[model samples]
Target: MTHRGAEPPDGTGFLAVRCDVTDSRQVDRAFEEAEAAHGPVTVLIANAGVTHDRLLPLMREEDFTSVVDTNLTGAFRVARRAARGMLRVGHGRIVLVSSTAALHGAAGQSNYAAAKAGLVGLARSLTREFGPRDITCNVVAPGLTDTDMARALTPEQQSELLRRTPAGRAAHPDEVAEAVAFLAGAGYVRGAVIPVDGGAGLGH
Candidate 1:
């Protein structure tokens, strides 16, 4: 697949790089390389993630730390770098990939939920600090998505999730990606968290 830049279907101005979000060396190198290829990172999508699920009392230290390192600290690394560029240029987009668990609280996902929830605050804080510079920071909270990650679940679990979801099915990853793309494109929008959860957790 493509990794460096977007073609006609995607756009003229884009550079896509695969990076380990948890690693500072990789993040620095990737951003440096991407900036060289496509100018500064005007739009940042911190979507790198992983799951280490287990009940809190039964969970190991590594499990909790790993998820926190990747989901929370990882996004922070990328966003911090991107924000620096955005603040300097006086314009940018920072759309974080959060989760419905961030709000609803997953039974065996304390680490994941806490990490994702932190992103909302992080995005909002940036919005206040950088809004005058035309930088918009937002979050997209996706529900059960029909990705390899969800497909790995038992068939019964998948079916039950579909039953609970108002749309009666899992969402395509592109569906969530669309929300992120929207926030990226809309210059005036900032500090917003859009839930792409098919009405699964329309909280109070």
Candidate 2:
């Protein structure tokens, strides 16, 4: 999962490893390591994702499956494990990072859209299962953020995004982070998909 990209903390508290979220073993290791040190995950942010933006006819089978596995099922892997701990502790938070494509269709992004859309269902299911235990689950869908991943757009593509988006520009990564932060900390929000799309995905 992507973080703030800031350097590691000077205090050297928790150990964060580079893990492929789709791989169950790696997901397990992340929890094990974090638990071995700090504690069972009290809060989880399922932000793992990937994109394979080829047209459907040209997109490889692996491209499609990989996106689903990483972006959707990967969140499940962490949630299932973390739920066990959260259940035992009786309180937790889970924020699944989705995308505006989950609600709005986009050309050449079928795989991404499907995976992201699935997160909404996942979040809702978690809320139903865990909300009574005080474990809130929600989704945060970010729009076109001005990160390296978004800047990959061609000039025309970027221009089209600006024109279509009521905000008139792409969002900053920090803005998306703020959405995640609020829902993660809020006490009542559950099974909601908070969009940080600057009105690009409004009315969806």
Candidate 3:
């Protein structure tokens, strides 16, 4: 696990530590450091995910399994660790960052879609388990966004996607972040899948 940023000044109230979510040891250590610096963790954003897109037939077993392990199981790892402190504190927020692909599906992204779809179940389950403790678990699913990942699409692919999107464009990363922020403050919002897509996956 490696991070490339310096810590904030003493009173800036922020810390970004290197954490490999797929590795439980690293996850635990990251939280330990956070708890020591701050107080008990009251909010958790399980947003670590990766994608390895390949047609189902040509996709290697490792590709499929690794995507699931990191995207789905990794969210589980971080949330589980955070929940311990949240439960003791008796209040918390857990927002899982998912994708529109999980709702509408995408060709050559079976593994990614599957892993993201799993987050919905994970969030809902956690809500049921932790609601009594005042811990809300929810999912924020974003569609194609104007990020480096979107910039990699071929011209034709990009054009087709934009044409299909109801908003006639990809989303801005800040739009998705805004949705996550809303959920963070919404203590009553639990087990919900909030779509940050520009109506791309509207029906679902």
Candidate 3 is scored at a TM of 0.92
TM-score of each: 0.89, 0.91, 0.92
Better of 1 and 2 by TM-score: 2
Across 1-204, the per-residue lDDT of candidate 2 in tens digits comes to: 323235545556556565667778877877887787777788889987778888999999998999999899998998998888888888898999999888987788899999999999999987887756789999999888988768776788778777879988899888999998898798799999998888987666
Where is model 3 more than 4 Å wrong at Cα? 1-13
RMSD score of candidate 2 (Å): 2.6
- Between prediction 1 and prediction 2, the one with superior lDDT is 2
lDDT, candidate 3, 59-177, per-residue tens: 99999999999889999998999899998989899999998889888888899999999999999999999856789999999888898777876788678777778998899989988
Distance from true position, residue 168, model 1, in Å?
Answer: 0.4
For candidate 1, list the clashing residue pairs, or say none: none
Give candidate 2 misplaced runs (Cα > 4 Å): 1-14
Query: Comparing 1 and 3 by TM-score, which wins?
Result: 3
Which candidate order results from sorting by TM-score in descending order? 3, 2, 1
Clash statistics: count for each candidate: 0, 0, 0
After TM-score superposition, the amount by which residue 177's alpha carbon in candidate 2 deviates from its true location, in angstroms, is: 0.7
